[model samples]
Target: MADSRSGRSDSDALIRVETLAKRYETAAGTTPPALNGVDLAIQPGEFVAVMGPSGSGKSTFMNILGCLDTPTSGAYYLDGRNVAELSDDELATLRNRLIGFVFQGFNLLKRISVADNVALPLVYAGEGKSERRRRALELLDQVGLAAHADKQPNQLSGGQQQRVAIARALSNHPRLILADEPTGNLDTHTSEEIMDIFTRLNRDQGITVVLVTHEADIAHHAKRLVRFRDGNVVYDGGVKGI
Candidate 1:
């Protein structure tokens, strides 16, 4: 199926998947594929939510889209690069450069200060210490945690911690942000706060934001929803209010 914004130039698309599929081999036998011939496209600056039941292939799809796992068959082109053909090191480099990831768990380093944690990706990118610290502080300010830059993640509330995670995800200035259940650990109030951060980033920076969640309330915040079932897309359309 076509995306809601038809006639989008292919070069402008941020993500493109063609007949993507993944299978797991077990001792019992080759089980049903986790993803079966899926096709999807996402445009830059679009906020899209993916929803599905457990084992519905949504997680697998996210993993593949994030380049943490490769598809067994079919193709995935991210930002015009063919991911299926990239070497392991190339894939890692591409992932680090093009995408930022946020998880349900805040995934913070317990011993590190908030600013240091936000600077971790830049460390891998070989940014100088001064540059890293400056960037980290900037991101902390962006997430409304500039005062907490000196504190550890454990000192913050769940909402504050997730905000830190969002800041860390944006540290590299990635074009796309992939968030998996980023609101799962938060209360309704905190969840709304986190979603607001996501929507703000999407709206202000033109960063493509795609999240996977089971909560309808959470998915509704996105402009479009793509529902998956039995390893295939069941729905792809704009939200009710457009």
Candidate 2:
């Protein structure tokens, strides 16, 4: 099926998949399928949400999209690079350079200062200490956490901690942002705030965002929505209000 878009340019596909399938085989030779022959295309600067009920394979899709796992079959082209062709180490390096991840739990180092937490990705990227600190401060400021950069995770509110997590995700200046229930831990108001931040980043920074969420209200914030059922995409379309 052809992926539809609203006046998108021809030369801007950030991710593409064809007949993507995933399955797991245990030691006992019991095989359970996860994804079944899915095809999708995501363009640059697009904000897309993958929504489904539990056990619907959307989680498996997210894992593959994030490069945290590989598909058992089919092809996945991420930023023009074939996922199946890359070595494990190459995939790790590609993930470090191209993907920024935000999880539901706000995965930050609990004992570190917010600044240090935000700098962790840069550290992995081999950024110098001074440069890491400088960039981390800039990202914290962007997320409105500069004033509290010295605080530990326990010192910040839920929303603030999630913001720090976001800054850490962005430290690599990745082309794609993969957020898996990023607002799951926040209150309604905090969730709205975080969603606003994501929307702004997608719009202003031209970052492609793939969000996995169960909430329709949360999914509405995305430009597009793709629903999964029975290990396959059931619907891929634009959100009603744009």
Scored by CA lDDT, what does every candidate get?
0.91, 0.89
- For model 1, state the Cα shift of residue 75 in Å: 0.1
Worst 10 residues of 2 by lDDT: 1-10
Tell me the deviation in Å of residue 109 in model 1. Answer: 1.9
Q: Could you give candidate 2's per-residue lDDT for residues 36-143 as a string of tens digits?
A: 999888998889988988888988898999899999999999988888898988888877889999999998889889999999888879999999999999999999
Candidate 2: clashing pairs of residues: none
Summarize candidate 1's per-residue lDDT along 158-184 as a digit string, tens digits. Answer: 999999999999998999999999999
**TM-scores for candidates 1 onward, in order:** 0.96, 0.93
Candidate 2: residue 170 lDDT (0-100):
93
Residue 221 displacement in candidate 2 (angstroms): 0.6
| Candidate 1 Cα outliers beyond 4 Å, as residue runs | 1-3
Residue 50: error of model 2 in Å? 0.8
Highest-lDDT candidate: 1
